[model samples]
Target chain A: MPFGNLTYLVGLIVALLIYSAVGTVFRTLYLLLLSLGFLGYISPESLVILLLVSSLSYACYSGMRGQTNRSLWFFLGVAINLTGLFFFREFSIRESWSISSYSVEYALIAVGISFYSLQNLGVLIKEKLQPSAMTIPFTDFMLFSAFFPKIISGPLLRHENFLPQLSPDRNIDWVPGIQRILFGIVKKTVIADRLAYLVNHNFETVDPTGWNNLIVAHLFALQLYFDFSGYTDIALGSARLFGFKLTENFNFPLRATSITEFWRRWHISLTSWLRDFVYTPVAFGLRGSVLGILLAILITFALSGIWHGLALTFIIYACTHAAYLMGEFLLRDFRMKIKVVVGKSVFNLLGWFLTVNLVSISFLFFRSTSCIDALDRIGHVFSCSNFFPSNWKSGFIYKIAVGGDQQNIFNLSITLALTFTVLLAEKYVYRRLESNKIRVGLMVLFMVSIGLFGVFTDLDKFIYGQF
Target chain B: MDNLTQIEAVIRKVFKDDSLIIDAQTSADDIDGWDSLTHLQIITEIEKHFSVKFTLSELLDVNTVGDIDRIIQQKFA
Candidate 1:
């Protein structure tokens, strides 16, 4: 079920209450069952696939113990997980390779394999390298794999960090968890869903005008940021209610002054995963060389793009990011020289401006239906006839949003205002406001805002849910 | 120099922060500008100074200065 669903919210509350009251011995099992139910509720086939994969991994783990060729078993485990991920993500009923009815059915029903495969691989690699660092009990491992909160889109957990926290003796911090959930609801429903209205219009326009492309480019970035991070907040909050802590996935990535810094902040878990497992390994032989760095970045990002899906648009998206990072690194000395000339404040302002636009422009590929579609939209930007922001005051907002209605304007205004409010608070206000009363007031405001402005009728699934 | 002292010097040189202190427990999280790219530079410098090549597994396994030191000492042995 979508985290934004009312039923999911009610279910979360019930689960949290039961979890808190249950004894330590039963707590883990209760959560494991809840997770199975959540997944089984959505796609029973997916739960079966998850169990099969988990069982295979456990069998491999058992085989590796006290064995001479532990590496063989470890690699087999990795290969199995990778095979499962690729098969689910790539295979379809339309493909000629769908030899049987069962293959077609399983391909269609597979869910969250993208996320759980990474989690499973992490355990295999970490345990192989560390050798008996933590002997995870079977139930704890199962729960780690199927934890309902982060199973969909993750603040992807590492074995060392997550496994240790599965103890029954953990204490619950009730208030902050509820506050986080409320904040997430406001972020997802009140802010992100509203922005999705305009963004969806922009995506649908076959012949986007220059102004349309330009405006929606930035809006899409904001829409995605709020949507994914909003989902994260709920996931973290839900896990928090159960006294389990997940790694944070975002750190105000939009404010990053450089693409390098942006990747460090944005989708931190996935980037770090690529860094540890993909980039580091590939770059090892090529370390301490400029060309090597560039090459490694290219390969890693290409893999990252492929991980999202096997599509030309995603490939272009990946290449664009690889190019950005490569360009950023190549010009580091130049940037430093310019920084010296311009002074830090001016330099940073310029960097922020360039980074934001570059990042936004790259999202064109990510949001496009195909590479040609993305290029067509970008082609609008260079057309001399559509150069000026011509439609301003007459129907600029209407053109961008594709509607001139009172309700549309209201939703757009609230989205823009809330977006800025959230940024400003995260950057400035929230840190300084240590008062519990004020914090509680803000929580209540969030609840009120959701009740008032939340777009409940046409709820958009979290954008990252497809991944 | 001992492994820690040598590592400290290499880190300071690579990061261009001579004032930076170092210890066995020091890791990427503890240092500024010690991101993935600069990390390779530090490792290369250490390899050059010690005349030892680290395997990919060894590199992956090294989380802190202590891990690096232990690996280097093992190589020497």
Candidate 2:
């Protein structure tokens, strides 16, 4: 496949124009959506399936007018959405002759469905219970569901949060929006993309044998964090430009000393969603039982794991997290005791290092293709079996990067460093946004980032574009 | 009469907020520590101390310390 899916690109531009200047917002919105969906490689049946399920729910929501059983209907909506996803993925993958060889193929069009399904589901349910909240015109509701900024990936828009923002008649602060766009571009293009080289190199090879490989693994962890969170920053910043305040996805997760705390900070929105909608119910209903907590941990992580794809690697990834959380939960009292007793900087740093290493090991599941592959990779890494040892010399590093991956190690390092610095800088930017001076600083930073690196062409698509 | 002192003590004990004061009009909204997440933790501790289980609806509907105290009074009285 070529780099550009030109059909979707053309379709996206047309849809945007229509969205920006349409008569009846609902009808225009519908037509625009129809066009975007058509741009993708979906079959007639799947397209119909998508439209039918969505329309049915919206129609029910409109008709009920605060009269229907909200929870039951909402669950039904999720069921329908997940079922469609299952059928498309399960059936297509099983059948050797599936069309387009995209059993669970993703492109531009599928960007918002994962997040939008939840948004629309929440809206429909909220309609029956809190009708006054459903003030969005049908058109705006559709836009909110398929908002381009978050459609590909999400800060998982809550319906209650998104709908009202759509109706905002406030003046557009062009300056802030442009600044956010600049920050997003730097995170996505320059830094994250650069770090991606090292991350991908380390993950693609089975070697974890040498100290170099170990360092690579650590770098891989950093790279993954940068890439995903960088995407999220862009997603959020873009969402902000339109006056739609998406939830913060990352909260300086590298600072977290424990897996439990890391998840709470990283992908905070989705993890929180899984907690509120999945984990909490399971844990609470279990009533402090160890078995309950374990089961809840497993189930939540499993779903979280497979949310990436229907693959064994993801399954392992989930299990690793499940184990980490369970271990942390089990050792909570013991840890608090330990913390109180030691209460030292060295102990805290060691704890953080140990926790990060454990997390990196878990990423083996995410990076590898299968459980066996993941286990083998971990075995090699631990056993010091250097499958791809680095020379460590500047000359050799340059050669391996240039002659090897068609990318230079220096370029990768500089990019990753710049990206990391920007994110760290954003920590200051976030706080300083309250001040005029820092806001001006952010603009200068933004301009420098823009002049340095353009927006990622992949901006229209999220990393988790497939599932 | 197990007046405000007992209720206040329970609030202080449950939240580790010895400064918590309970009065007739005092509500969860007015207290800095009275988040809904921690609300049940307090209720559960109170139930352990006083020996009663609240109905689900009652648990969901609670807004004030006085409301909880009144409910406890009703059951015990």
Local distance difference test, per candidate? Answer: 0.79, 0.60
For residues A147-223, what per-residue lDDT tens digits would candidate 1 score against the true structure?
99988888788877888887779777566566677677777887777777777775776444676687788888888
Candidate 2, residues A1-467, lDDT tens digits: the string is 11113444454346445544544434435543653465234344444554665666666565555455656665666676676555554334421211111233433223345566656665654454345543555566555555555655677877656665654353333445445555555665566555555555545555444454455556656656765676666556545544457777888887778787688688877786776566755655664346876887799989887666667777888888888877776675577567668885765786789888888877766765567867876776677345454455542354325334434655655665676676567687656542223367567766677567544544433344455
Query: How big is the positional error of residue A255 in model 2, measured in Å on the Cα after superposition?
Result: 1.6
Best candidate, DockQ-wise?
Answer: 1
Task: Kindly provide the TM-score obtained by chain B of candidate 1 when compared with the true chain B.
Answer: 0.96
Residue A415, candidate 2: Cα error in Å is 3.5
- CAPRI classification of candidate 2: incorrect
DockQ of all candidate complexes: 0.58, 0.15
Position A64, candidate 1: lDDT: 76
